[model samples]
Target: MDINTICVHGSAHKTDYTGSVTVPIYQTATFAHLGVGQSTGYDYSRLQNPTREQLENVVAALEHGTDAIAFSTGMAAISAVMELFEAGDHIVISDDLYGGSHRLFHHISEKNGLTFTAVNTTDLLLIEKNIQPQSKAIFIETPSNPMMQITDIAEVAKIAKAHRLLLIVDNTFLSPYFQNPIDLGADIVMHSGTKYLGGHNDTLAGFAVTASNELSEKLRFIFKTVGACLSPFDSYLLIRGIKTLSIRMERQQENALKLAGWLAQHPKIKAVYYAGLPTHHGYEISKRQARGFGSMISFETDSEQTAHQVLERVKLILFAESLGGVETLITYPMLQTHADIPASEREAKGINERLLRLSVGLEASDDIIADLEQALR
Candidate 1:
């Protein structure tokens, strides 16, 4: 079936008993078994739930992975993935990932003896140079967060295979609709389902999907042990939101390109960082590897004052944290998304006071453009 058809009807949610088109919330914590030493596939909510499984199955199918595990939040999914490595193991990661993920590696994982080396993963050579003997995986965000830096996924996957290391791609920016990293050779694909998969920004969820059964086994063990599983209701919400993903992404991308073009031409703008723009350094790479340039765009103004003025003056576009919703959101990475990053490191990646990241929504292009125009003026 086509992807859009799968989005709405490809769910593994068939309860012939009730004949409900949607997956019903299996709210109970435990399920009654048929008999001793026998099961009906589900015994506990923590291990699995009917509703969550429906979402998981759909996600796995969408990403072309064998199995998937859903989580309470994006970080939880990543936390479970990190457990696949040992204490002394290491990994190479994108230098400009979300602040929360950076915190996970630098603070939690590093303290636990799992180390990381952050590099600009867009350059395959830089990633290759950073891989150590103990490096177990390559963890990267394509069209990386805030900066919109694009990585050549297939190239990096080759490097990972040559080194016998796992390749983990966070597909939150592109979602499964635009890019399936696994199809391009990713060992595992993760998502901050709170963003695009949830579409409405009303649910907090995460997903870790893998084509390799070995990785799936390890992740399943960690997911059950850590107990960061998504709730039945939230899983239902995600399933509902994902049904419109293809259409929503199409509209969001259209609005984003228009906004990025407008911002790039503005006199006060310093630079616009969107892979969709022909002038962007990663534009060609983005086109070669993915279906489309995603909606997330970051642009810088002449001064922090200008950024703050725009943030405060905007009436329609909300000044908020988080992205991939139906409504437009403007976030200041310096304080909002990437605040956990050190000032020196943040500025080094061009996420400075003057930088603003936009999560273009399903709003009308003219309204989104007009709001930015008046705010910038």
Candidate 2:
């Protein structure tokens, strides 16, 4: 089926209950067994739920993967994948990663003995050089947070295959509508469903899709054992959100492109980091890998004072930490999202004090642009 059709009807069907067009939420905690050791597909809510299963199937289809597992939050999904590795295993990750991910690798996981090297994964040579004998996985986020750095998924996957390393991509920014990393040869694709997958700020969820059965089993084991499964209610919301994903993303991307172009020409803007902009360093590579340049963009001002001024002045866009909702959101990476990272590391990665990140929404392009224009002035 085409993507549009898949969005509306994928992994869901009318049930006998009401013959409703939407999938009915199976809200029960546990399913009754027919007899001893004989049961329906589900046993307990924590292990699986009908609503969550529908969402998993939809996300798996969208990502072009064999299976998907939904989680309570994006961090929970990341932690589940990370659990596949042993204490001594090393990971090579993109330098300009999401701040929460950086905290997970640098602080939380470090105490458990998992070491990581933050490198520019866009440069395969640097990534290859940093891989150690114990390197088990290549973790990356393309069109990276704040910086919008694009990584070559295919190239990185090839390197991972040759070196026997797992390749995991955080596909939160581009979402499945814009990019499918599994098709590009990634072993696993994960998302902060709180963002694009949910399409609204109403729910918190995360998911991971795997390309191979072997990897799927590993992830499933970790997911079940760790028990961070997403709630049935949020799963229902996520499925509904995905139905309008393509259309919402189209408008958001349009607004983002226009805004990026305008910001580039503005005198106060020192740099605009958006793949849609021709001058952006990642524009060419991003175009090759993604179906569309995503709605997320970041820019830097001359001073931190000016950055705060812009955020305070912007009336239409909300000031918040999360992204990929129907409403536009603006955040300061240095203070809001990337605050956990050390000042020295953030500065080195160009996540400077003057940088402001925007998750463009499905608003009128002209209105959004006008709001930004007024705020900048």
Candidate 3:
């Protein structure tokens, strides 16, 4: 079935005799049992809700995963994934990941005795070199946050298989409409449903999709145990948001490519980091593994002053944190997303004050480019 079809009808889990075209939000906290030892497939809202389950079903189908667990936020979903590793288990991760993931590993997970090594996953050799004897998994974010670095998912999956390690991919940037990491050998896929899946910037939600039933059972256990499940209303919003994901992503990518080309030619722009650009290091690899270049783009301005000026000057593009929404959002990694990392490390990764990330939206290409034009001036 086409992804667009799945996006539209995958959540059609028939729950009642209402014959409603849309999945109804099951708002109750608990279900009444017919008898002792009897069940309606759901006993409590914390464990599972019909609305959230439908949302998860759509995400799982989109990612080609056996199951997906929805959470209150992306961080909550990530936290549950981290719980899969025990104390003293080490994981090799992409160095240029979202700052919140970095904060979780450095401050929270490390304190719990889990170890991590951050390396450029694009370099397969470096990934192998950094793997410790106790390494349990490889977590990576292709088209990595802010920097837009792309790692070959198939190659990394080979490394993970050879070493008997779990492969987890953060598919937030590209979303399932553009890429399905599980099909490329990822054991699990993560999504910040608040972004592309939600389509609108109105809700907060997250998901952990498992490729295998074993992993699905494991993550689900941790999910219900942690109690960070998404609310029923938010689940409904996500479902509605996903219905338009195909169209939204298509428009967003079209605008992003136009904006990226314009930025690359601009005198004030030092460099544009977008996978769609032929000059990008991972352009070929991205083409081989994904369906689209996606809508996220990051560029470095000629100076910190120029970057600040653009952030303050943009009228159509919002100066805000978070990406993959209908509204175009420009973010400063140095202060907004990657601030948790130390200054030296952040600067080393080229996430300096001069760098700005752009989340192109469902706006006209000319209008989006014109907005940047005036801002760059």
**How do the predictions measure up, each by TM-score?**
0.99, 0.98, 0.99
lDDT per residue (tens digit) for residues 127-157 in model 3: 9999889999999999899899999999999
Model 2 TM-score?
Answer: 0.98
lDDT of 1 by residue, 1-377 (tens): 78898899856556436777777888889989899899988999999998899899899989999998999999999999998889899999999999999999999999989999999999899999999999999999988998988899999999999999999999999998999999989999999999999999798999999978988898998888989999999999998998999999999999999999998999999999999999999999888888999899999999989999999999999999999999999999999889989999999999899999999999899999999999988
> In each prediction, how many residue pairs overlap at the backbone (N, C-alpha, C within less than 3 A)?
0, 0, 0
CA shift at 73, candidate 1, in angstroms?
0.4
Clashing residue pairs in candidate 3, if any? none
What is the Cα root-mean-square deviation between model 3 and the actual structure?
0.8
Cα deviation of 158, candidate 1, in Å? 0.5
lDDT scores of the candidates, listed in order: 0.93, 0.91, 0.93
lDDT for 275 in candidate 2 is: 87
Per-candidate Cα RMSD to the true structure, in Å, reads 0.9, 1.2, 0.8
Candidate 2 residue pairs in backbone clash: none
Question: lDDT ranking from best to worst?
Answer: 3, 1, 2
